[model samples]
Each structure stands twice: as C-alpha cells, then as structure tokens.
Target: MTTSHKQAPAFRPDWAFLMRHPAHLLAFGFGSGLARKAPGTWGTLVAYPLFFLLLALGAGPLLISLLCVPLFVLGVWACQKTGDALGVHDYGGIVWDEVVAMLLVLAWAPAGWAGWLLAFALFRLFDIVKPWPIGWFDRRVHGGFGVMLDDIIAAGFALAVQALLASWLPV
Candidate 1:
C-alpha cells in the first residue's frame, strides 16, 4: 500500500496578508513589493519619497544615514518573520532590504536629480548582479541578517562608484 501526501499552496501576499502583520507590511515595503513585476525596483523607489519626506521634516543627510542602522535592525527582524511565514528566506517580495539599502545610498547621494538617478541605477545594478563578495554573502548567509547584509553590501558598491564618479566628473 502507498500513502499520498499533499503540498502546501504557495504563499501569495495580497493586501490582506500585508496588512495582517506589521512585519509583513514593512517587509513588503508597505505594498511596493506587491507589484506584479520588478518588485525590487518598486521597493527601491519607495526610498525616494521617504528620503525627501525626512528632508522636508528637517532631517539632514547625516541623520538619515544614521537612521539606516536602526532601520536595518528592524528589517532583519521583519524579514526573518515574514520569510518564515512565506517559507522562503529571501522571498522576492520581501523588499525591506532594498528599501533600507536605497535609503542609505540616497542619504549620501550628491545633491541633484542627476546624482540621485545615477545612484539608483548603480544600486540596482549591483544588487541584481551581486558581484564577488556580494554574491558570496548572499549565498552563504541565512535568516534575517543574511537577507539584509547582501543589500547593504550592494549599497556600499553604489556609494563607492558614486564617489569615484563624483571625483572624476564635474558636477
């Protein structure tokens, strides 16, 4: 005689799931992760408005940059919880990593649209490509810290490239 087993349905986060828990909401980038395609890009976009909002409210680059530390800590917890629920440690929809990392990149971004655009493009490129140590960490790391660290590294890459360009270019 043989026994049959059933597989669990894949978790698809809708507004209800996102709203079900605070972690889900944050881990999903407050709904940006729900986009049908390019959720990471959408999640990264979330940082722009937030960066400007903080600026409008009197937070400077120094303060915003400092804020990334705590935000990263929070993302670790939120991503761990959300990932556990979703059963995929780095679910594509869990994009708080992008949000926090982009915030870091934007914090140091030069003061102009051109600089910000370059920063965004570079960040996305590093994140998607995950070269060398970035790819190494992404594969070896696990859990919330893992989910967060790789993106932070990508942010560092973006910052480094931006610095190089700033020094070499006139603007």
Candidate 2:
C-alpha cells in the first residue's frame, strides 16, 4: 500500500503583497523576502546591519538576548497576519522568522565580524537542512507558532555550533 500526501500550494509573494499591511511589510523583511530565489538568505543578510546597530548602541549580550522574547512575540503576530493574508503558513516569502533567528544566534555568538559570519553560515545551514527537532516542528506545527518555531530551533543549533567553534577556532 502506498500513502499519498498532499502538498500545500506554493506562493511567491510580490512587492504589492507586502504593501497590503504593516505586518506583511515587516514579515517580508522590507522586500528582501520578495527575492525570487533564496529569500531567507536575503532576509538574514538584512538582519546583520540591524544587529550591528544594536551593538553599536552599547547593548550587551544580555540586552540583546532579552530582546528575543518581544521580537519573537512580534514576529509571531507579523507572521500570522502575513500568513493569513497570503493564505499560507510559513510562506517562503515571509522571512521575519529568518530575521529574528539571526538575532537569537548573534545574541550568543562571539564578538567580531568573523564570529558573526560563522553564525550566519551555520544558521543558514541549519535553517535549510532542518535536522531533527527543527524538521519536526516545521512538519508538526502550524500557523504563526509553526512558522517561527523551526527557525528558532535552527538558531539554537547555530548558537551551539558557534559556541563550539569559539572555543577551538581562532578569530
């Protein structure tokens, strides 16, 4: 006997789709999420400067880490609104999850451009590969929580990788 699974409809949100609401605008990462290819990568790239801005303001790791709670909350709401508008949960073009995930990874990442770069690569790797728990959440969860949970798991993985490398790798 063969089991068949139905796939969710694919959607490629355009610029106008993001313009419909403020949440959509943010969830789309100010249009970076609208990229025809690798929208998540683009969204992650957009996160770097924002992270730097907070660091530049003298926000310590603790502050940055604490910010994750509110950011995740906002991200959930934004993702929910945008997902509802798009009629898809965790749409590829909805990239606020990537943006927030970068923040979580960087919150624990070592200081310096090299550290940030490594964190970025690892986060993207796990986000794309979705191993173990991340894949489980991505498959089992739905709605806004589902959208953000997998990326948050990926960030946790990236954080561990970054910590492991920081002790051994020279920057």
Candidate 3:
C-alpha cells in the first residue's frame, strides 16, 4: 500500500466570516468557541473574558451576569461556526456554557473557593455523566441556545447537589 504524505492541518482564523456579523464580537465569553476556532485555544482564552469582564466589572457581578445573556446568544451563534469548522459537536474548549453556569452557581451558593470547587466538580460530573434531561438536551438540542441549555441544566443539578451536600456536611 502506498502512503501519501499529508500536511498538518493549519488553524485558520475566520475573521472575514465573523466580521460579517457584529453580535458575536459582543458576546466574548459565549463566543469563545468561535474565538477558539479563530485564535485556537490560547488566543480565545486570553481574549474571551478579558475585555468584557473588564468593561463589565465596573457594573458589578450582578450586572455582569445580566450582560452575559446577550453575549451568550452571540456566543451560541459563534459556537455553530466553530462546530462547523472543527467538525465536532460540543468541543470541550468551547466552554462559554461552563463559565456562565459556574458563575450562576456562585450566585446561588455564595461562598469562597470551597463552594467554587464543589461547583466545578459537580458541574463537570453532571455534565460528563449527562444524567437524565441534561443528557437528553445535550443529544437532542442543536445550535447555540441548545448548546448552552444542557450545561445550564447540568449546572442546576450541580447546584442542587452542592446545596444539599453543603447543608448536610456543613463544611
């Protein structure tokens, strides 16, 4: 069998395609998927939350969460593009959902690193386990809102578990 040499697939930043729509830029966190596709992982990571969080920090955490919704909408759109580019469904790096869910969990639990760690573990567990409706949504849903919904559901499960565990254990 003759083997043909193939070049390594290079990462392409889809600036032109992205620039056609401005909403995605506004949605930095959620659009990290698109950013991930364009800048790859590192570029997306640095830029994803930096400018928005900075511009948003002045408004306070509550306002920041509120602002994230629009960003989320746009991010979902961006995720669609990224998914197409990479030819995968729900790439791990495109984690705007995780960010949003994590913050929302914090909003509910209201504690220090302990709570954050619990939340992180629980969210990841539920998300990976994909229990019940979270799994259903993750499989059935498509596009941006769909992408965000399953993680939100997973976060809900995570939040509930953390709350119960926190109350019971009292750590």
* Candidate number with greatest TM-score: 1
Write down the TM-score of every candidate: 0.92, 0.91, 0.61
Model 2 has a clash total of: 0
By summed lDDT, which 10 consecutive residues of candidate 3 come out lowest?
1-10
In the order shown, the candidates' Cα RMSDs to the true structure are 4.8, 4.0, 7.7
Candidate 2 regions with alpha-carbon error over 4 angstroms = 1-12
Q: Compared with the true structure, what per-residue lDDT tens digits does model 3 show for residues 1-171? A: 111112221344344544544533322343454543442232223432443454455654466457557756766776565544544445554566666665555555534556656756676688678899998998788666676788778868987898887754435
Clashes of each: 0, 0, 1
Evaluate model 1: give its TM-score: 0.92
Best by the lDDT measure: 1
Sort the candidates on TM-score, descending order.
Answer: 1, 2, 3
Candidate 1 lowest-lDDT run of ten: 1-10
User: Against the hidden true structure, what lDDT does model 1 obtain?
Assistant: 0.89
For residue 4, model 2's alpha carbon misses the true position, in angstroms, by 16
- Please state the error at residue 127 of candidate 1 in Å: 0.3
| Per-residue C-alpha lDDT of model 2 across residues 63-154, encoded as one tens digit per residue | 98888789889989998887777677777878899999898888788887788889999999999999998998898887777888899999
